[model samples]
Target: MIKILKEVFQLYIDRSDFFLEILLQHMAICGIAIVIASIIGILLGIIISEFKKTTSPVLSLVNFIYTIPSIALLGFFIPISGIGDKTAIIALAIYALLPMVRSTYTGIETIDPAVIESAKGMGSTDYQILYKIKLPLATTVILSGLRNMVVMTIALGGIASFIGAGGLGVAIYRGITTNNAALTVAGSLLIAVLALVVDLIIGTIEKFIKRKWKLN
Candidate 1:
């Protein structure tokens, strides 16, 4: 086991460039997808919040998309987008929309009704109430949703490698196909470490926001 571990470490050191490239590609896919999803999610959340009756149905539809298998979804889009980063981004974006949309909607909706009424009573327009009261109050929840979306995007980006999206997943898939257990272990470890680092950063941000906003 020690010898195998040493070999894996050595392989990582020697192929660090390849690993970095994979990491960059993964980040690109995840970052872009999350950004797009967040915009759409927040907008939909805002719109749905305007109509209390439609919030549940709209969120339910988004949640349903989350249940579809990533691979199957990718396959469904392959013909339209072809196999590459585009399809990967689209799939991950769709998957990410659920948490963000739900969190945003729930966060806004769950705000104190009294507070909203107070804002209105103070001569605040509908736009002012939304921007100043509802959104500010919901900031923590929105951030939490973004955090979840980031984590999910990273995980799914890995699977996107199977379809030629090129990332840590490529390293992993190649390792498996070539029967290089060392490579597979190394690649998987790289992905795990990357995800851990990202989550840690996001967690720190979430904590800061929660405290700053006194959400706790």
Candidate 2:
């Protein structure tokens, strides 16, 4: 184990460029997926929150998709989208919907009814209420969801290399096949570190937002 650790450390230092290339690939894949999930998830969340009637069915569908195994979902998309980052992004985005939508809904729903009524009394337009009141107020919770989605997406991005998406997973899968423990361990560590770094950044943002809100 010590020998393997030494080898992995040397590879990280000596071949930083090689790892950096794949790291960018991983970020691009996961970043696109996160954006897609946030847009559609937030939209669905808003819609369900407003309509209330649609909440059960919309959430139920998202929940169902979220429950599908990531690999199986990727396989299902392969025939239509074929093998590439697109398919991986789609799969990751789908998996991400539950957290984003749930948080958005919960954040909006939990806001005191009186606050909204006060906004209405102040002659706030629907758009103004949503833009200024609901979203701004719900941002902390939404950001919390964003953090989870990002971390989860990055971890899942590793599997994307399996479908030719090209990410840290390449190192991991290739290492597994070729029995290169250092490569495999290095890839796993990079993915984990990426997740941790991203989570911490978002957590910091959440803290800042919370503090600002409290001050107000």
Candidate 3:
């Protein structure tokens, strides 16, 4: 194990450029998917929150998709997407939806009903209430969901290699196939580092949002 570790450390020193490229690809894939999921998830959350009857069904559907294994979810998109970053994005976006939707809904729902009533008394239109009151207050909770989704998407981006999505997963799969434990460990460690960096950045953003909104 020590020998493998030394070899992997050497590999990292030798192939820093290659690993950086893979890391960028991983970030690109996760970034795009999360953006797409955020747009759709936030909309779905707003809709379901407004239309209480739809909440159960919509959440149930998103939860079902979230439960599907990442590989299997990617496979489901293969026929139409034909295996690549696009397919991976689609799968990751689907995987990200549940948390986004749930958080948005819960955040909005948990707000004091009195606040909403006061908004209406002040002649705030529904749209005004949503934008000025509900959404601003719920920002932190929705961001919490986004933070979780971002971390998970980065981890899953590694699996995209199986479908030619080209990320750190490439190294992992290559290591497995060629019996290069060093490569596998290096790839895995890079991924872990990437996830940590992203989470920290998001955590910083969350803190800023809380302070700005005076949620603390």
What's the lDDT for all of these models?
0.86, 0.93, 0.92
Which digits, one per residue and each the tens of the lDDT, describe model 3 over residues 1-216? Answer: 899889988998999999989888888888999999999999999999999999999999998998889999999999998988999999999999999999999999999999999999999999999999999899989999999988898998889999889889989989999998899999998899999998999999999988876754
Residue 116 lDDT (model 3): 100
When sorted by TM-score, best at the front, the candidate numbers are 2, 3, 1
Q: Write the per-residue lDDT of candidate 1 for residues 1-216, one digit (tens) a residue.
A: 787679889987898898888989888888899899999999999989988888879888987888899999988899999999999999888888988888888899899899988888899999999997899889888988888778777877888988889788888898899998888887777777877888889889878877887754
Query: Residue-wise lDDT of candidate 2 within 14-125, one digit each (tens)?
Result: 9899899999999999999999999999999899999989999999999999889898898899999999889999899999999999999999998999999999999999
Clashing pairs in 1: none
- Candidate 3 runs further than 4 Å off: none
Which candidate gets the maximum lDDT versus the true structure? 2
Best-fitting candidate, scored by TM-score = 2
Report the Cα lDDT for candidate 1: 0.86
TM-score winner between 1 and 3, please give it.
3
Badly placed stretches (over 4 Å) of model 1 are: none
Q: What is the Å distance of residue 90 in model 1 from its true position?
A: 0.5
